[model samples]
Target: MGQTLYPAGCVLDRTGKPVTGFAGMGCEMSSEAIVRAPGAFVPGARYAQHRAEGANQVFVDVDAYGEFYHDYSPDHPMTMMRDRDNRLARLSLGMTHYQLVMGSENATAWSAGVVHYSHGTAQAHVSIVWKVKNDKDRFGGWWPSDRLPLFFKTFTPTEDEARLLFGAADRLPLFDAVFHDSVIASDRWEFGLMKVSGMEGARFARALLYGTPTIWPLDRQEVRRTGPWLKAAHDDFRIAHGWNAPVALTGFRWETADRLVQTTSFADGRTLTANFSSTPFQGLATHCVRVKRPEKAAIDLCPPALPTR
Candidate 1:
């Protein structure tokens, strides 16, 4: 098969509507939207391990489709990258689902979004994102603080502050994140530079700019492309939101001559593995699997339990 050069696309809203432009738009759909549209959500098989353990956990894995998986914990959201030396002040905890923005040639950039549904509670949050415009290197985009979890709701950074924190030239990149949680906790979240390569960054940029992946109601027949760009945008969403943990994804479990990479580890007694395929067609895809229950013995062994008395 030949490669697609400058393939056309557009951005879709939660209600399956096209987003007209990039000017301060919000997600109109609600938590019920995800519940009603089962086809739009990722498969249950993809979440088997996490489902077995429970819904709320500090760390979790996400499948970016094709062949990529990454980790994230509430403590540090961007653990998959090298510059993840920061803490998470607040995080949206719930059953999270992602979507791609595909439309006609009217749009000019790449974008994706995430909707978080609170488990055992009637609350949900949403985030629509895009890559920074005019940036030639690294991965970092503009994310609106409009709907952040309660604790950091007031976190409105100036253009310079946001650019410095994300290490991007554009103060406002793309995407709008909506966090809707009544309870906000006082937590620590630090901002740092994002670590990414030129090719990786450019590929993601191109994906957003060209590829047309399938979305809800709109299947492969509708989009007409495999949507590698959409997958890349989704992967970047995890990066921007700090969904993976750094300590857990430090090294590789295995790597093949064909450029397939895997990382496996044991955290809190549970077995976890992340897979990545660096091939050009499937480079941005991610798949993750977690197993077993957290080890009570490991928690008991922590030095904090020694007691100060």
Candidate 2:
């Protein structure tokens, strides 16, 4: 599997700082912060928790197949990530935008666009997403006014049960993201900066130059060669979309602005493509997940109550 293994990676600052503090995440006596938001922040927001299908984790490994286990409530959506206190983070983290794009992908009985199905029971789902800034300011809140990024619905995959759902020649949950040193506007591929290093300390750079990993291992010829190639691809994917494509992706190719990444059609309802762009990297980073039975159902998705003032 020359394809890289999927691991949790994060974006780092030039000084190698990984954890970023939200300058306004929890501002006191401020009408601008979401945590202190009026009507937006629910009182005792921490005490409420919700669930579904006898599970609470959004991504559950059931019988080796995955499904979105809901613990969501009228007060909170169980799909987003939780913070230190085992409670939802106050800031509308990436999940907020991710859910908006996934509204159309929900396979649950309640989704509107979904054709109520009769089969292996709409067991799992995945949403392919791309987020960029836009000029829409309608929500009437701080989150809406701060020049929020625009998230587009690239594609959505709802699987019929969870076997053989992965492999070549079909749309797999793993998104194929490519990182180019330019601005990209399509989901066929993504490009971003390489802020994290892999097994070897060979950090891939954001430019066409500085592009080689001189720190190759003394042994293992294949690792030495593939490492740099993989690093460059990861950087481009992150830079273009503010996120990283799945590392284990196979069966996709290079696409670009003029001729960009060509799209691949598959049976599992997922699309794959590559990208080539000419925009420089921005101050953002992202990581994509091949969620099994993703819990993006709108019928039961809502953010938790915001912590009180």
Candidate 3:
């Protein structure tokens, strides 16, 4: 399991006063301005002076990858450059000595060199308010039902959120351009093939567009239910870009106003085009993923459409 270690210090505002929380930090505020003063610590009284004064190490799990920043503690200052170098050194050591395939949670541009692939790169992180409104049983425990709940499968983002999360207009294929040859990028495992519900078509389309490998949860029953769809998607991807073909994502553009198309160029002079349009494309009944490879006829992968709203 991958982990990120952050140095402990009190987060400070622009005026150098320690902020209580992350709210209203704004673009001007720097998290790196955190100080190691005793008054700055949260729950200041609980931690003794000796313990707080000692080297502060905060460990974050793979699921909640923490941000990397400079630590301004005069005693043991950790700069951004130092942190990155440390991470790179560690990753290099692991790969070289252990012959391990290194992966992480989120694929930041800087870490792309050492890390092989990353999950949770594409996800609509629901706000706390939305979570509370939607998932009543989240805080209070509830018995598991025979079938998965709608909350687990479906999510509807607001217009701004949708544009930020799902719209292809503002996105660039820079990551694929740089690391597509070596890495197998993917979505979060929690939102895998059998997990996502209403916006399944959009997720699949995004995967094809980004040339990312599909993430599948390790649930036997769920796999039994949705295995065929997953297999077919994989098969289409595998056939288009051969098992060992030197493939590169060549082009991505808006085919139509609502339609996003991605073209993958293979080393063998063949190209694969994946055209994704919102469900009911040209009055079609289902959400469709249109894929065409050189010399082969175009095939549409249409699944039963669901209400995204």
RMSD of each: 22.4, 23.3, 9.6
Provide the lowest-lDDT 10-residue window in model 3: 1-10
Query: How well is each residue in 159-261 modelled by candidate 3, as lDDT tens digits?
Result: 6655655555556666676667766667665456544334566666566556677776545665666666677668756654557833666655555564455
TM-score of 1: 0.18
Scanning candidate 2 in windows of ten residues, the lowest lDDT window is 1-10
Off by over 4 Å in 3: 1-66, 72-76, 123-163, 168-170, 261-268, 278-309
TM-score of every candidate relative to the true structure: 0.18, 0.18, 0.62
Q: For residues 1-309, what per-residue lDDT tens digits would candidate 1 score against the true structure?
A: 011110111223334343343345532212122222334332333344455666333322111111111222222122222211111101111234212111111111110112221121110111111232223222223343442222111233345434333221121112111111211111011111111212223222322211111121224432243244344345533332223431221122443453333323322234222223333322323322222235532111000111111
Candidate 3 residue-wise lDDT at 76: 40
What is the overall TM-score of model 3 with all chains considered together? 0.62
lDDT of model 1 at position 225 = 35
- Which runs of model 1 end up more than 4 angstroms from their true locations? 1-132, 135-251, 278-309
Sorted on TM-score, best first, the list reads 3, 2, 1
In angstroms, give how far residue 205 of model 2 lies from its true place: 19
Error of 2 at 160 (Å): 16
Candidate 2's C-alpha runs over 4 A off are 1-44, 47-163, 172-234, 239-309
lDDT of 1 at 264: 31
